[model samples]
Target chain A: MSLINIFSDYTLRTVALGSALLGAISGVIGTYTVLRKQSLVGDAVSHAALPGIGIAFLLTGSKNIEWLLLGAFISGWLSLYIVNSIIKNSKVKYDSALGMILSVFFGLGLVILTYIQKIPDSNQAGLEGFLFGQASTLLKRDVIVMSIVGGAIIIIIALLWKEFKLLSFDPEFCQVSGFPKEKLDLILTTLIVIAIVTGLQTVGVVLMSDMIIAPAVSARQWTDKLSVMVILSSIFGGLSGVIGTIISSSTRNLPTGPVIVVIISAISIISLFIAPGRGIIWRRMRDKKNKKRLNRNIILNSIYNLNIEGNRIQGYSLEDLSISKGDFNFPINTIEKELEKLETLDLVKGKDEKWYITEKGINEIEDFRGRLEE
Target chain B: MNVQIEIQLIAIVVALACSTLGVFLILRKMAMMADAIGHTILFGIVVAFFITHDLNSPLLIIGAALTGTLTVFLVESINKTKLVSEDSSIGLIFPLLFSIGVILISLYAGDVHLDTDAVLLGEIAFAPFNRFVVNGVDIGPSSLYIMGAILIMNIVYVSVFYKELKISTFDPNLAMALGISPGIMHYSLMTLVSLTAVGAFDAVGAILVVAFMVGPPTAAYLLTDDLKDMIFLSGIIGTISVVLGYWTARIFDVAIAGMMAVMVGAIFLLIFLFAPDRGLLSIMRRKKRQKYDFAQISFLMHVINHEGAKDEREELGINTIHEHLGWNKEFVKDIFNNLYKSNLVYIEDDIIRITDKGRDLAISNAEEIVNGI
Candidate 1:
């Protein structure tokens, strides 16, 4: 479907609007997620929500998104509670508790989901889709709720942005300075849960986890500053939602959830491999160029050394020293380039018979050898 | 009747595997990877099924386990690069794999009896239907056997390598200095986590695989300090959660596994507010007690410093008040035993006296408190 068609298409618009708002919230919340080093808290809390959703559905016999999502929100909060408790009570770290709560809650969720699947009375066929969200199911009204929640999340993030950043960097310092580190942490966690629960109604479960993580990953690659990371990640998230909608609408059988997921992953990969300082490919290219420059210098120095060895400073064939230089030279053209550079530097003389080292070249070669030995 | 019990046994076996693996994951702080592995295994399960053309074959688990291993590598490699953060790496990798799984399900496995979702998170209530048979006599659920095998492997692995795991977890750099490969230990831990997730998938699905892997350990951690104690407590907590959760579900007529998870969370919240030392109530209690003792000590020192008092007796009546120090009558009684035990004062029936030893000690303590030492 085209752009005009997308506007007219309720399903497409609903999912796009819902996901965009949700993305903004995750981005805003993810600032804290990345800063607090609790970035995986998204997946942890999301997984933590599962068993609760299953329990809610099982108890209520209702498919109402609110009740189920509330259950999820409680579960997510509970995971955070357990994480904090582990950190406080034992010597175990936050990541471990995070890991523990994440797996256990999700495992329990799965078990319940499987059990629910067998229950003849429950019509829970599409419940698994909630694991990886499907924004396509969102109605126009749901989009409105998502946008409101998204707006609120952004506002909350904006208000406590400094406190959150300060607290995340060093809670001890914040506490010493009389800032409420626990309160800030709670606010961040609460906002994250809100973003996640809002997304839950749209994207579902598993993909919701990715959406929370993906924008931050992309944003992190693009910027070092937290403010910039939050903004950039939100933009990527918004783009993924819009793009995912377009793809999902064009294809009949394709759903928006996986398409959105793929788009986000694509953005992450691009950022990972091609973004400025952090990009893998750029660094690799830089490393290769530096090595090439080093090889040229090595060749130039090798010729200068041969001339300074006190052998009449006469023509020495390239074949005479190729093995001695450890075969560092690449090709005939490369050798010619280095020799030309040496001549240009006025460090050598006698072009045709094999270059002779000038006094300047001799001194330089001796210095290079001395430095290498040292 | 027996079949239902066998099905429940399958879940418990998976829980056993998860708890064993969960402890290491908790120790390594990589417990959330169970969620990543659970979701990504969907792709491997689908791919394996397409290749083998049979969903129930052992190849599915093997292929999924392999992918789970690969997922660990992907996440770890990203972690090593120091480019992407840990959570972001996990959030990035698992979704892509899961998306691939979702796509495969849509394009190819949509019509299969065992679809991607089903295979990724099998039916716990129906696991008993897929029973093993030998010589025409029915054995227990195949899942029970699979999970049992995994649980045994994990128990043996953990039991044998507890010291190694403890060493590596607390200080990986130190472990490396002492001739241990932290990387090896880490990958081994992830492997156990992945194996647990895969084995549990047939009975508990992906999320519970995560829940079982993380919940018990976290709760246990909240209640204990020692690692050895944490593991044992976590195992007990896991089994208790399973049993209690099942009962709650039965009583409430709801989902058993979900109730179990909620129960785990419930127990955790209770312990969070009540456990000793770091617990909310305990910390408050300690603070209140410290303040009360501080006030009492201050009063006792004040009474001893009143040099003009000529009372020969050591007892301070309940009504006695050092009004010049602006003290209350009740505080003298409060400080009586405390000051006497420290030998800072001698109390008779109706008056109190500062002895030579008591006076000297009181002066030193008063100076320390006044100097803020």
Candidate 2:
């Protein structure tokens, strides 16, 4: 089927739009988490949201999405607060505290969920979806709620962009500037909680961290500027959502959460390998060039030292240099290759099987030595 | 034995093992890696099943080990890039592996007994049903034995390598300088963590495995400063949590694993508030006590100075004491009451007199203050 046909489908469109909104906001909010080195904080808060959801259902006696989400928001916020408190008040480190809150809250949530399931008249048919996500079962009303919540989160993030940037980049500077750092941190965390809770239904608890991390990681490979990274990350996140929805919709019995995770992971893997400057491929190429230049200089230095020792620059072979500069560990082929480059650069002359360093090579070596000293 | 007894035994063993290993993880600042390994073991099981076409293959352990190492390697590799921090690297790798397992389950074997739900919410109550029978004799619960052996392995590993583990955990550079390979120790520990996590997860589930790994050790951390004491205390704390958790589960008839996790958290909570020196209440109490002690000493010094002064009008009366000390009436009264109870002061009517002990304390405090100690 054509792309138009897929977008035209009502259920698919709603699911796609909902997930896209979730992805974009999480991606944007996730930048702060990634930059501030609180990436696992997202993971912790999302897991902590589970119990809040279960408790909300038990207390309300209804599985209303709004009440459930409210419960998750409160739970996530409380977990963040607990993590902060543990770090501040005790000797426990940050990661352990995050892990402690995450696992405990999730365990409590499980207990509550099991308890709710045992109740006779409970309408908990879809509550378990929050564990691994059941985006395929999303209703139009659910999509509407997600859009509203996610939209508000993104708008708030946009409004507080400068403060968020300053907070993420230099919290000490923010404090020195008397910027209400604690309040800003609370606001940022609350926004992350809202984003996590909203996305919980679509991607579930286990895969939600991927939704937050993958887009930001992918965008980071392509840019250094925070503004550009933010824009790119959101686009990557939104694109992954749309792509994952389309693929899952076309496939039979495929869930959306894992599919979305897979799609975003692919985007990040590609970005890691092939993006400019920061990419593995580009970096490797630059490293290779630098190594070659260093090798050429080393060979020239070896020849210069040999010339000074015996004034014999005409009959140097690869074996001679290899034995004299054994620390270089240069193989025969590598020595020959560097020598060939030096010959091409008119810094060396080769005749028969021996290589001679020209006056240009001597001058080049002197210039390199002078620059090294300075 | 009954399933309840079997589950309790399994819980104790798993908790002991996880909490023991957790001390190193916490010290190494890699506690979240336990959470990552717990989730990614599902991928290991899935791939093992796919490769062997047998869900119960023992080779699943190898797959688990491979993927667990992969997780550690990936997190370290990402962190080495300096693009992301250690926690971000953990966050980056965990979900990707777990999601792949989910995708595999959904695409190929959703109909089979291989389940994500089972992985997430393992049933300790049903552990006895999956018993190991040898030669027509039931060898009790398989989870019990598996977890028991794992518990022993963890004990042996930590004991045999205690010095190495301690050196590496506390100061890797020192370990390296002393000819110990911190890298090798690290990978070995990660391997052990993966093995213990998978075995424990099969009995108590992933979330509870994390709780046991982190919660008890953290509580122990808050309670002590010595490494050996931390390990010993974590085991004791974990055992206490399991015993209490088992009773709570029975009383409520809730999920045993979840209840155990909650109980572990509760124990940590209590310790966080009441662990003598490092706890919240104790710290606050110490601060308050320090303030009161400082005030009492200052009052003693003031009285000594007043008596030494040439002005006879500076008498040691309650009203004068309050005014001279700049303390409120209630605070002054409390200080005076404490001083009199300790015999550091003699009170006759409205006048206060410093005792010999009080004079000595004031002189020593003056010495300390003058020396700027």
Candidate 3:
């Protein structure tokens, strides 16, 4: 591809659209999944869809995407039901339930697929691709289906937005307040199952949840507002899809799904280091600046202690601590810098490199170390 | 019929192992770890295949188990950082590796028979076909043996370290204070889980592995409060559900693993709705009974207290009396009839009378009833 080819309707409307839709929806739903701590529910349910598709292929011997998808839906729903049952009935937390179902169902799928492979059957084409996915192979029809599913997800999420927000934030409260938590939970889960089943072919269950969660997670780092989070997540998701398909289509055997995940990971890394609030870079810088202030304050307080004892504080060496501590070379240098800073403020005086605390420095030190009170 | 029997045998062992691992996984809140690890093991398997050049080689299990268990370490390590939350870290790691595994298997080892599809959904019917035999006399399934050895190993490990596992799982801080390294315990658990998944992978693959791990333990968890009981119940539930799921697969002509998982779900739902004390229906039944008994006694007490006449008024107010009783009005009439027939009360134009026995019982044992003693 040339640039013109890349932008052409043929390339833009088929693979790009499907991946983008799948990625964006995953991004949106993934936010809640991540925050509510049900992120693996996506992966688990998606994996669960495998056996359903396999069995469908076995029984129907028909390669209709719809039939396979119906199988995917049943199995996916069944997996979710199992997870819910585990969570509701047992002391096993939701994460464990999600994990358990994810492995067992996918394991069962593998067992089935292995058997299918041995039986000399050709009906399981594209079933294995669902373990990951090939976005480059996504068709215009697949794009249409994905977009419709994505649209339905958006609308349902909108309708249940309030209840979902409440339930996600405080399910116990939702239950105590009588907001039909069980039905709401069921509906929310159903929507997720539907989404997983729909995406089984188009995105493959393997990379889909990462597509869903990565954008939302990266978006969360960029913004505190929910709407902004959703919008940013969708954009990141769509952007990842577009970029992932381009990269994969450029090289044969390059997977669209994992590449999509890698792109999202890059964005998340950027936001984690550079975004405000909890961003690493911001905190590092803030800590550095705070350290300078702390050093100055500590040195000034030490000088004030000498003054309170009515000593000249002129014969002091820098090495001093009530407890065993690190070496004094760095501390001495830190003290010199603070002394200079205090001198500029007229809070300290130096005679031949021996420093004494002025009244102002004493007062400042007293203020920095607040009065102890009961 | 023979295939179904063999599948059931495999499923039972697999379910037992999965459920055994699941009890710990759920307790540790790392259920998705099993799922993520299962998929990621494809990469390990393929890598092992490259090195060992045999899909069935023990090296594959070693490499795959190492990778699966390390996947846990990776998830936890990533989670410790601020960049990715716990779930996000989990979501990110496995699929990337899994996708790599899938793509590589397709490109590098397409003919190796251990592709992504085989890792996701496996057939239990074919499990028996891959036999480990000595001198042409078949001794059932090879996978069954692996699962059995693992089940015994895990049962022994869990049994020997039951208190430690419980302590670490329930309160790691306390466990640490008591000289147990919670991290080590967790790692051991992860190792066991990965080991179990790899063994089961040969027989049932990943999806059913998760179902077996999660379903029975959860059902059992709901039915019992005791840890030992929960373990036994979960094992029983896992075995029963596998048989039932395999049976359903036969009846419906559907996939065995899928049917098995659905069967587990059905059992869980059944337990959810009707498991004697913990089921929703049981809870409802208990509530109904409580309401009935409360109303019966309250009506009996009302008759006793109002036998002559209310000190403040000629007739007792039902609302006032109910307010004092704090019971639903719906049960009052039914309780009144039962009281009347039992001679606990006789109503003459609603001026109720409490027999002497009713008065004595109400006064003497009111506190005991309130306390449910």
**Best-performing candidate as measured by lDDT:** 2
Lowest summed lDDT window (length 10), candidate 3 chain A: A320-329
DockQ top scorer:
2
User: What value does the interface RMSD of model 3 take?
Assistant: 4.1
Q: Tens-digit lDDT track for model 3 on A127-202?
A: 6777666566677777777778789899988998888888877899999998999899888877777766766665
Candidate 2 clashing pairs?
A: none
Q: What residue runs in model 1 are displaced by over 4 Å at the alpha carbon?
A: A2-4, A49-75, A103-129, A156-186, A225-227, A297-350, A356-374, B115-121, B159-166, B170-180, B219-234, B266-373
Give per-model TM-scores: 0.81, 0.89, 0.81
Deviating ranges (above 4 Å) for candidate 2:
A300-336, A346-370, B52-56, B297-363, B366-373
Q: Could you tell me the TM-score of chain A in candidate 1?
A: 0.79
**For model 1, what is the error of residue A254's alpha carbon versus the real structure, in angstroms, after optimal superposition?**
3.2
lDDT of 2 at B37: 92
Question: How much is the lDDT of residue B269 in candidate 1?
Answer: 61
List DockQ for all candidates: 0.36, 0.71, 0.32
* RMSD after CA superposition, every candidate: 5.6, 3.7, 5.3
The positional error of residue B131 in candidate 2, measured at the CA in angstroms, is 2.3
How much is the lDDT of residue B87 in candidate 3? Answer: 77
